[model samples]
Target: MDSRIKMENSMNMIFFGPVSSFMRIDAESLLHILTFTKKHLIPISRTILIWDLITDGKTAAFLYSREYLALGPLLNFVPEEDLYYVNFGDKSVLSFFANHNLGLHSRKYGILAASYRRYYGDMWYEDSDYINELGYLICGFPAHIISKITPAVFKKIDVEIFKKLSLCSVNQTKTLYNLATHKNAYGKPYKWSSHEITKLDILFICVPKESISSIRLEAIPAISKHIMEMIHQDKLEYFTKQQILRMNPEARRMYIIRVQLRTSLDTSQIAKQDANAIKKSVPLALIYVFTLILK
Candidate 1:
C-alpha cells in the first residue's frame, strides 16, 4: 500500500475507529502520539485521551493546540502542574483564559504565569550565546514578570509584547496602555482617540464600565464572541450625555426620540421565558436575581 494510505489507515484506527485497540497508553506515550500527530489530533470526547492530558504535569504543553482550549473550565479543576505547559502566547489560548475569568488573583492563574516565566528562562540562551531578549517577547510573558524586567532589556521589547500579557490588573493595563500610547497620563484618562482604544482588546476588561464609545465600533473579532460583545457594546450604547446636550434643540429632540425607540427595542429583546421565570421566582424570593431565584 502507498504511504498516504498507510497513514490514513493508522489515523483511522488511532482516532476514528475504536481507540481501545491500541495497547494501554499512559501520559508519556500520549505526548509522543500528539507530537507525531501534530495538528492532526482530532478534538474528540474520548475520555481516555482527555484523562491522560489532564492527569500528567509535563504532558500539558505537549498537548497544546486550539482544540484543547475548550477545556478551560475543566482544566480549572485539574492539577495546576497539568496546565504548567500551556502556551499563553496564543490569542486563542488567552481568550480561553479570559472567558473563564483567569486573571489576577485567580488561584488557577498562578501555574500558567509560572509556566510562561519558567519556559522563558528555559528558552533563553546560555552565557556563551547571544541573548535574543527581543525574540523572547513572542512568548507572551506574564504581566508581573514584565513589570520586573530591567529597563535596558525592557526597552528592547516592543509595545505589542505588553499588549499580549497573560493577565493584567487595572493599574497594570492602564500603565501599559499609557506606555503603548505614549500618553503617560495619570489615573488613566478616558480621552484617548478611537484608534488607540481598539488596541486594548482583552485588556479592556480592566475598564469594563467605561463609556463604550471609547472603543471601536467593531470589537476585536479574533477572540470569542463573549469577549467581542463587551467591546462592541460600547458602539451599541447610546452616545454620551454631553454629546446629546450639545445638540441643537431640534436635534436633541430627535435624539431623545431615537433613544426612546432604542429603549423599546432593547426591552423587546428580553426573552419572555426569562420574565416568566422571574415571575415564578418572585413569589418565592421577592424578585431578587438568580441567587434568590435559583432553581
Candidate 2:
C-alpha cells in the first residue's frame, strides 16, 4: 500500500503491523503532517519505548542463551542509557545486541550468524589476545557488567559516542531522541481499561483511517446507550447469559437462561432503582472508551 495515501486519510497509521518489520514516521514528520492536515490530531501523551530494540546483557542472554553466554560479559558493560540517543548508522549497534539473542535460537540461525560475522568481522574476538592491554575492552559490555570488568579494559574501548549521546547533545540530531528516553519530558504512562485497550487496537491498528473518526464517535455512544437501555429495561440478565454462552458453549444447559437473566436483572434493577448509579457508570465507561479510541 502507498504510505502517502494512508497518511493522508489518517494522521495515525502504523507503517508495519505489530510483530512485523516496520519503520514509522518519526515525531518530526508526524508534526509536519499534522500541521499540513490541519486536523486537531490527538497528541500521543505516552512515550513508546521500543524495548524490543534495546540490547544489554539481560536482553542478549534472553535471546541467544549460549552465544550471549560468550558475548554477554562484554556487552554488559555498554551503558544502555548512552546508546538511547546516538545514531549509529542505518542499523544501530545497540539493535545488533538486542536482536542477536533472537537469532541464536532462531530457525534461521545460520543466516543470522553469517550476517553478524560479516558485519562485525573478526575484530570482536581480538579482545581474547589483548586481554592485558585492553582490560578496558570488557567494559564494552552492558551497564550491569561494567562493575565486573577490569578498569583498564574499560579505558581502551572507544565509548566516545556513548558518552556524547548520554549528555543529551549531538550535532544536528536535535532532541528527537527524547521519544525513546526522557520519561517526564516526552511520554507519560497510560493505564488503560480493557475496553479502552480493545478500542485503541481496533481504531489505530486494524481499521482504515477514513472510518476511524466516525466509528470511534459512534462506538462510544452506541455502547453507552446499549448498556444503559439494557439496565433500565431489565434485559441485562438475558444479555449477560448470551455473552456467557458465546464465550463458553460447554456451560450447563439447565442454568444457562437462568444465569443470563440473573446477570441482566442485576444490572437492569440497579439502573431502575438508582438514577445516580446509571449516571455515574455510563459516563465513565464512555470516557474510558473514547480516550483509547482517540489515542
Candidate 3:
C-alpha cells in the first residue's frame, strides 16, 4: 500500500508531548485518568493506553508495574502482558502503531490497509501535566500490534518466504495451509526455537511497508536462506547463536512444528532445505521429513 494509506490505517492517536514529558505522572494518577476516561468521555469501541516514558527507565518501570495491571484489562485494545515491555522511544512507538493497525485489520477485519504512519512534531509534548489526560483521549482506539525487527535480522530472511509468512493473519484452524506448503516446498517441516518464535513475532509485528514491499521485490531467496538456517539451528530455544548449535534437532523440530501449526505459515525455506540436504547425513532429518510428508 501507499504511505498515506498505511499511515491512515495505523493506530489512530495524537501524542501531546515528548516521550520524557510523561515521567512526572505516577502510576496511580495515570490509572485514575484512564479509568475516568473509560467511564465517561472517549467514545470508541476499545481503548489502549500506553505510557511513553522514553529514557526515564526508573519511572517507566514503576508505572508499568503499578498502573499496567490496574488499567490493562479494562481496555479492550490492550496488548498482551507478555508483549508489554517495549520501549517508548520514537521508533518503538511507531512500531506499536503499526502493530496495532495490523492486529485490528488482519485478525479483526480480514482486510488490511496498505500503509500506516505516526504524526508528531517537536511541540507534540507541550502539555506535560496532562499527558495522562491525553492518553485517556487516545485510549481504546483499535490498533494493530507492531514489533521492531533489527536490520541484521531483516537481512537474514528470504523475500518470498517473508511474503508467505507476511500473508497477514492466516486462519489458525486451517490444518494444511500456506505455512505447511512452504515446509513441504523445501522438502521438510520447518522448525523454530522459542526465542526464534519470539523474534519472528517481533518481525511480523513491526515490519515496515517499505521493508515488506522491498523484501517482496528483492530479497525472497535470501530471506528463505536465513529462515532455513534459523529453523535448522532452532534459533528459538536460545537467544544466542551458541546455544542454538547445542540444541537437540528433535526438540527443535518439534518446536518448529508447533509454531508452524499455530501461526499457520511456513516461515523458513532454509530450514527445509537443510533438512533435505542432511537427510542422508542425519537420522533426525530423515524423521522430520518423514513426519512432515505423512502430515
- What would the TM-scores of all predictions be? 0.37, 0.17, 0.22
- Residue-level error in angstroms, candidate 2, position 181: 28
The lowest-lDDT stretch of 10 consecutive residues in candidate 3 is 108-117
Task: List, residue by residue over 104-202, the lDDT tens digit for candidate 2.
Answer: 222222233233434444344344233222222222332322223333332333322222222121211122222211343222112222343232221
Quality of model 3 by C-alpha lDDT: 0.32
lDDT tens digits, residues 1-295, model 3? 6986654433123223343444455645656555443332333332333433221334322333234433433333433332233233334433333333222323222111111112232232233321222222122222221112223323343332233333333332121122222432321112433333333432332322232322221122223223433332333322223222233455445545543443332447336666555444435544544454455
Model 3 ranges off by over 4 Å: 1-90, 97-167, 171-248, 251-295
Top lDDT prediction, candidate number: 1
- lDDT on C-alpha atoms for all candidate structures: 0.43, 0.31, 0.32
Q: For candidate 1, lDDT tens digit of each residue in 1-295?
A: 6998998777667656666664356655554554456332454455345546544424565554443544434444555566676665664554454344322244456566566555446433222121232222323334444344343443344334435544544555554444443333212424444333334444444443454334332322222233333333333233344433343455444434443343342344455448665455333322211221132
Stretches of candidate 2 exceeding 4 Å from the true structure: 1-6, 11-144, 159-295
lDDT over C-alpha atoms for residue 124 of model 3 = 26
